[model samples]
Target: AAAPAAPARASGEEIKSPMVGTIYLQANPTSPAFVKVGDMVEVGQTMFIVEAMKTMNPIPATRAGKIVEILVEDAQPVEFGEPLAIIE
Candidate 1:
């Protein structure tokens, strides 16, 4: 079966994955997520971690704005250039 499409956003800048890997929304299992829907974020803020080739790489926000949506689930596999979040 085909996966459902992500909800269309009226206005927001998307944060895209830098590399193909598994995405972690939190620093650790018990830690709060780096950012969530409705949260305000600054440019360069760490938003997610993409583990590639056994290395953990922190993914930073490219623009400052309120996070409108998180497109990926915690620990989900992601592809390079995939949209991870929406900021407006």
Candidate 2:
């Protein structure tokens, strides 16, 4: 018998967070956020930037959809696999 395949992911939705660090909504306190709730996002588009150990990293969207929610606030600390935002 053949081995079973992995289950498929849900359709039309994605939540991407691939690291553990401080998630920032804006590049700086005075700047606007990369994205906001209800904004339409495309694959590879930056959702937000995270700061860890003085280094900044941009988190990109994995799928194209409208942002349903923002899970973190400005300067909020986040962990691995944390839900940064929900898109659908």
Candidate 3:
């Protein structure tokens, strides 16, 4: 069977996962998310944390832009190359 297609956005650059793991949108449960929709981000800004094998890897933004959409929820499991958010 074919995998379901990911939701398509009107326009934006996608920030994809570099590893398969659980994605964290915030530093901790009580903290604000690293980035949210409509937030402007700069190159190299920490966008999300991918926890793999008990290690937390900070994922950085490769391009500077305003966050248009967040594709995954906090603590959600993500696959390698999975789209995490969209920046425009």
Candidate 4:
């Protein structure tokens, strides 16, 4: 008999950056940010966008939760696996 298929895994909390680039807060100067502290977020929602190699990528939320803190600031450079924001 054929083997049974593996069950699907559960989704967990995480921060996902769309691309490898500098992180910008607002679209431009004198503009508000895409996200902020104590903001409620939904799964698959765009928290921010990262620009890498002249390409803009939207960063989405992995799980639904409220933003507890922001680790990075506007116009700050971030690396992979960097904690951009804390969700709870």
Candidate 5:
């Protein structure tokens, strides 16, 4: 199957995975997602976590902005520089 097209980036910023890992959209499975499309996020705010080498690492927004789209699914394996979410 063909890969999904690149998501539109309004501000041209994305929260990328720092290491190869599995992405978690919430603190826990039952908890609400850390963010959703259209939610406003601040700099240093915890957006999501990546489990690498059995460690959960929080990913933060480098700048404050509204979330335009979520590019990753919960528990999905992600690579370094992969777009996790689009913020603008």
Candidate 6:
């Protein structure tokens, strides 16, 4: 009998915050979140937003992948290079 194949693993890349700011999971409180764990995303897709210096900046995905982890909470403060999510 042939041996069973190994299960596919998530080679998720850790997406970090680009600046010091508050992380926004959705466009607004009433809006659905931009993404969540297990959601598939394309390159350049808006993953989240950050508010810094009174500006809202949308964060895009660097590559096409599925989200496997969310490391930050909605409206939570984040610093540059802080791991925000894991994309596979």
**Candidate maximizing TM-score:** 3
Cα lDDT for residue 52, candidate 6:
98
The sequence of per-residue lDDT tens digits that candidate 1 reaches over residues 10-50 is 47888999999999999999999999899999999999999
In candidate 1, where is summed lDDT lowest over 10 consecutive residues?
5-14
Which residue runs does candidate 1 get wrong by more than 4 Å?
A: 1-7
Task: Summarize candidate 2's per-residue lDDT along 1-88 as a digit string, tens digits.
Answer: 9889756533345565688889888878898899998899889998888888888999999988998877788888888888788888
Which of the two candidates, 3 or 6, achieves a greater TM-score against the reference? 3
lDDT, candidate 4, at 81: 77
Clash totals for all models, in order?
A: 0, 0, 0, 0, 0, 0
TM-score of 4: 0.75
- lDDT accuracy of residue 68 in candidate 5: 89
Q: Write the per-residue lDDT of candidate 5 for residues 1-88, one digit (tens) a residue.
A: 9999865566658788889999999999899999999999999999999999999999998889999889899999999999898888
Model 6 lDDT per residue over 1-86, tens place: 99897555446798889999999999999999999998999989999999999999999998898899888999999999998988
* Per-model TM values vs. the true structure: 0.89, 0.80, 0.90, 0.75, 0.87, 0.86
> Deviation in angstroms for 50 in model 4?
0.8
Ranking by TM-score: 3, 1, 5, 6, 2, 4
Q: lDDT values of the candidates?
A: 0.94, 0.81, 0.95, 0.75, 0.90, 0.91
Q: Which candidate should be chosen as best, given lDDT against the real structure?
A: 3
Writing each residue's lDDT as its tens digit, candidate 3 over 1-88 gives 9999866684888899999999999999999999988999999999999999999999999999999999999999999999899999
Which model, 3 or 4, shows the larger lDDT?
3
TM-score of 5: 0.87
Ten residues in a row with the worst lDDT in model 2? 6-15
